[model samples]
Target: MKLVKHWIEKIFATITEGIVGALDVFFSSLQKWFGVGSMPYIFVLPNLLIFGVFILFPMLLNFVYAFTGGTDFFPNRRPWVGTANFTRLFECQNFLVPNSCSEDLFWRAVFNTAGYVVAQVTVMVAMSLITALILNRSIKGQAFFRSVFFYPVMLSPIVVALIWKWILQENGLLNAIILSLGFDKMPFLVDANWARFWVVIISVWALMGFYTLILLAGLQSIPADLYEAAKIDGANAWQSFSKITLPLLMPTMLVVLVLSLIRAVQVFDIVFAFTGGGPGTATLYMVQYIYNNGFASPTKQYGLSASSSLVMAGALIVLTMIQLYVRREDV
Candidate 1:
């Protein structure tokens, strides 16, 4: 076994050295030809090309599609309609009432997405904070508990949604438990309110662990001497945490807040897999709205979908700007 391991290590080392040597020779020749000043661009060219082709090009195309009346997939064939798509989306008799909008489903999706972002970000931050605080404490089986909490984060969103859907469905595990407790079975996914509630709950359950881990790392990075000094000053646990822990953790918390907000705004997969935006579009969000208009709907109005995505992107930009301004003011 030892002999085999030695030969395997030697072979890997030889291969690695050969590859490095070839790369050095190739780059050295290129550097001599192109001059040292251009080497940075040369090295970064592949990534730049990839980003341009895959990300930047698609984004510019979407902008073009947003302005065009496009039932056609080809850009040249799509007729220019200027801001008509945006006008249609904003056409509302009463913006407060989605039913009064020209594009009522779009308005409904906007309102739903707004509500979901608020609720999910709030709950996600709070639950993550609590969980991280607990996990940071001296407790028995701490590692085991941490892993158990983080286990849900490892599951695929579709799988997580499916598992929760089964539990929440009528005649499923939760309903069975309710019946055994002498209570009537309740509609979970079949009702609008219940479906919305469960969607938020399940999303929090699936994603909270990731945020908790972030907060835990933030907590660990805080120096213990600060807490000890606070203790020596006759500070209580609450005072120590507020004065020591929270201040140091603010940057991490800000990261969590921004990430959770962005994610909450873009929420679709779990809600889609769990409820399919049913119970009369209760869980329908911006991404799903874009998907429906872009591809799922019979009409396949790509222009409207692209316009909607641009609107969603604008909202995200606004959110990020607001957070940045707030952070700057604090600093």
Candidate 2:
């Protein structure tokens, strides 16, 4: 076994050395051909090309399409209608409400999305951080518990949604359990408020483990010596955590926050599968609305869908920028 291990190490080392030597020679040649400054561009060109083709092109097309009444493909004869899509979207009202003046469905979707983002992100990040902190400490069977907590994260979102759907259904496990306890069978996914509640709850449950793993990685990256120094200075657990752990963990926390915020704002699969936009559009998130407008509905409002997507993307960008700015000031 030792001999096999030694040979394996040698083979891997040789292969790595060969690759490194090849890369060195290739770069040297490239520098000679394109000059030293241009060599960086050569190295970056592949990724730049891919990003331009996949991300930039699609975004540019969407922006253009938002201004035109186009279907799946761009209309050849349609004239440019400046801001009409945006205007129509703003003026649109909920289908169920005939005379309600203030409750525009688009605005409702935006508000609901904002609320969902705030609630779920807060709960997910805080719970994940606490879980990470606990798991980072010395504990028995830490690996097992970590895996158990993170198992939900490994499952597909569709699978998670399906399982939760069944669990939260009227006659599902939850109601069965509640009935057993002599309590009324609650409508977890039927009532508007209750449906939204379960959506957020299930989202948190499905995502907390993933965020916990990320925070745990960050926690482990924190040097033990810092904790030791805090201990020597007579810092209690809470004091040390507040003064040292949190400050050090801020960068990772910021990353988790941004990611969670993005996911929350763009949430679709669970919302689609669980509520299908709802007990009367109560849980209709922005992405789901976009999906409904672009594809699911009989009257395909492509322009409106594109406009909504652009709006959602812009909102996310602004929020992310604000978060980054805050993080920078903290640093």
Candidate 3:
């Protein structure tokens, strides 16, 4: 038995040595051919190729598609329309009214997305900060509670949507509880306002956990002696938090803010699977608008969708820039 084990170990060691030798020879050849200075770029070549193929190429194609007009999926078949797509998108008798626009649904989606972003991001950040603060303190079952909060983040967006949809449906758990308490069955997803309400709530519930963990990490990173020093200086809880914690945590808060903003702007899958952009297009967001135009519409307009996406991308860039500027100023 010992002889057999020794033989097995020897075989494994030989295989490992062979792999290491092969890798060393390969790298040595690369260094000889490309020079040592280019080794970093050579090492990074795979990631660059992947980025170019997947991200960079698609971004460039989107620009091409945005300038061309047609129902055709092939770029060659599509005709160049210059800025016609943008012109049509911005065409409006009155900017505020959806019915006044050439692309009424697009405008509706813009408004819906705007409202949702504001409501969702605000609530999510606030809730995450509060939850993080709570969890930062010593408590029984702290690890259990942290796990519970973070569990939703592990769920697929589709699964999160489906779970909420099941609960908010008329004959679902929520309605059952309402009836059990002798209350009327409310139309949670059937009314526009209610659909909008639950959309924000469900989104916050699904995502707040991730931000909570981030803020919790930020909280834990703060020096314990800072709080102790604050206490010695006659600082109250609020004073300690506002003076010491808030300033130190601002960087993490900014990161959370920007991430949440981008995520809220790009909200689609969860709301799509949850409400399907109805009770009369009430929950229709920008991404859903793009999806509907690009693929789901009876006559798909790839140009219009691409143009809308570029517009959305521009908004994200502007938001990111503003956050970065704020962060820079703070620094």
Answer with 2 or 3, whichever has the higher TM-score. 3
Quote model 2's TM-score. 0.80
Candidate 1 residue 131 Cα shift, in angstroms, is: 0.5
**Candidate 3 residue-wise lDDT at 85:** 96
At residue 126, what lDDT does model 1 achieve?
A: 98
Models, CA RMSD each: 3.6, 5.1, 5.0
Candidate 3 whole-model C-alpha lDDT, 0 to 1: 0.94
TM-score of each: 0.89, 0.80, 0.88
In candidate 1, how many Å is residue 44 off?
1.1
Provide the lDDT at 309 for model 3: 98
Candidate 1's TM-score reads: 0.89
For model 1 the local lDDT of residue 250 reads 94
Report the lDDT tens digits of candidate 1 across residue range 249-331: 99889988998998899999999999989898898999999999988999889989999999999989987886786577557
Clashing pairs in 3: none
Error of model 2, residue 8, in angstroms: 17
**Candidate number with the higher TM-score (1 or 2):** 1
Top-scoring candidate (lDDT): 3
Summarize candidate 3's per-residue lDDT along 1-331 as a digit string, tens digits: 9999999999999999999998998999989998999999988999999999999999999999999997899999999999999999999999999999999999999999999999999999999999999999999999999999999999988999999989989999999999999999999989999999999999899988999999999899999999999999999999998999999999899889998998899999998899999989899999999999999999998999999999999999988897787678656
Give the count of colliding residue pairs in each prediction. 0, 0, 0
